[model samples]
Target: MSNDVFTPSRPAPGRTRFTTGPLPVLLASALWGTTGTAATYAPASAGALSIGAATMGFGGILLCLVAGRSALRVLRSAPVGLLLTGALSIAVYPLAFYSSMALAGVAVGTVVTLGSAPVFAAVVERVLDGVRLDGRWALAAAVTVGGGVLLITDGVQLGDAGGAVAGTLLGLLAGLSYAMYSWVAARILRGGRHGSRAVMGAMFGSAALVLLPVFAWTGGPLLSTGVGVAVTAYLAVVPMGLAYVLFGAGLRHTPVRVATTLSLLEPVVAALLGVFVVGERLGAMAWLGMAGIGIGLVLVLTRR
Candidate 1:
């Protein structure tokens, strides 16, 4: 994850202004928008399994090598409880997400899953961790969640159609899992940046191990399909791998609320990408729906 490499450094006095620390997060999110179109190239014959495993493996190795001994220490020094917990918790998302993308389209998969994450994160952090959401953020949440609902339903048609159902459920579950991941990773990174990065990679590796078998059966086909394969690599390395690292970095600096709020931008970005990059044409209503999302984000940023 090249994104991880640019984790914003802690600022000394007079060092960080408003945009000072969020640069990596912004860049990472931008690159993350590239995932959907890229995955189209992977072998249609292969499921998302191979794609998930290969990327995690590659990302883990890259992180381990770059961080060296510090990375080693996260695996070695972690108490049993935390290590097992991290491994088990981290494993759920990639399996859910890549498969979700295969079952649904990239536009649907990424937007739906990540769209729900902040809402879930807010609730989880508030109840489980006792974090609170104030007035403006709540409004922001409503607008964002509403926008997401529109995006997912594709003009607000809610039905039992198999593809739609799979996309909605998987995406919801993925969002929850991602929230958990962010929460747990934030804990590991709290000690220090070096130690944090190491532990995160180790955690990713631990989770990646569980996803290996799924890939074993399907990976060959993925490599055979040029575009899908390229997309898979991009998803694996950038969003899955690098994004996780940068996400960790951002979480370390921002509060759970702010972090969750900022994450809402992901789905909005995905929707835009679908529009421009993938030529996903939206009718006027859909375009208006997307505009609502933009307005919601603006409100979130500016609301007192």
Candidate 2:
């Protein structure tokens, strides 16, 4: 298959695209949803920054290892500016995402970070690729973001005002960073010079180098407890490494805007886990929000 997957001029057949695209992204989102809950099992001495660094740093390295020679070739051949942008965005995302959850609550933090990403992704597509999203995508994105807002509002209590505010800001940053890297990856994939695994491996491998110092500084507490080590390993292997591979593959057949919108599934999964696994309670509004998110996904998926 051509790696130039997202070009406006070379559209894939609708049936094939829709059928093949969404499943991997959805699976990836489901795995990503477990991150917040998994972090809860980490040793108390492991700070949020430590957990974040360890997850991405270790997982990024694993991606490079699995990708092997293809990753090295991509790094050597892909545009340096593009690779740097992706790496920096990847580095920023984990730090902000983890801190946002620690400062705000998991439900609120996850919703805000993920909800804002589609909008940012749309903007990135517009400005960089000159891509104009259709009404269906716009409507789907709006509905999903609205649902995410509702999901967080009354479902979980926030921390002190200042911390919540800071966390919200950080979550926005994380969202923007997430969008940037997603866009970068899609752009590289659309270049037709690299495979999904190669692109992801190259980007994340570069990012691991940037995150190494952070992890070295903060990751000491992770080794202090067996549970912490296990949780960190799970986060690195399952969510960051494997899930992102799935995400990159999905980007081959899905537009950046749609992919980010589809990722709204992550928060939905997270919310459900909170309610059932973590014994958190959700109000009627939260339930309605979940329904709205489902509606939005249906709208996008059923688009002709």
Best candidate, TM-score: 2
* 71-157 per-residue lDDT for model 2 (tens digits): 988889888999999999999999999999999988878988999999999999899889988998889988988888888887477
Quantify all predictions' global Cα lDDT against the true fold: 0.65, 0.88
- Model 2: runs farther than 4 Å from truth? 1-15
The superposed Cα distance between candidate 1 and the true structure at residue 181, in angstroms, equals 0.8
What lDDT is reached at residue 10 by model 2?
50
TM-score of 2: 0.94
Best candidate, lDDT = 2
Model 1 agreement with the true structure over 1-304: per-residue lDDT tens digits:
4332334455543335224334445555666666555655566676676766666655656655655666667777666676667666566776677677767766567767766777777887788778767888888777866765566666444344797678668877877887776776666666453444676777776676676665676678777756766666677678766776676666666555556556656666766777788777666655666676767767755543
Give the residue spans of candidate 1 off by over 4 A. Answer: 1-17, 154-160, 193-196, 225-229, 302-304
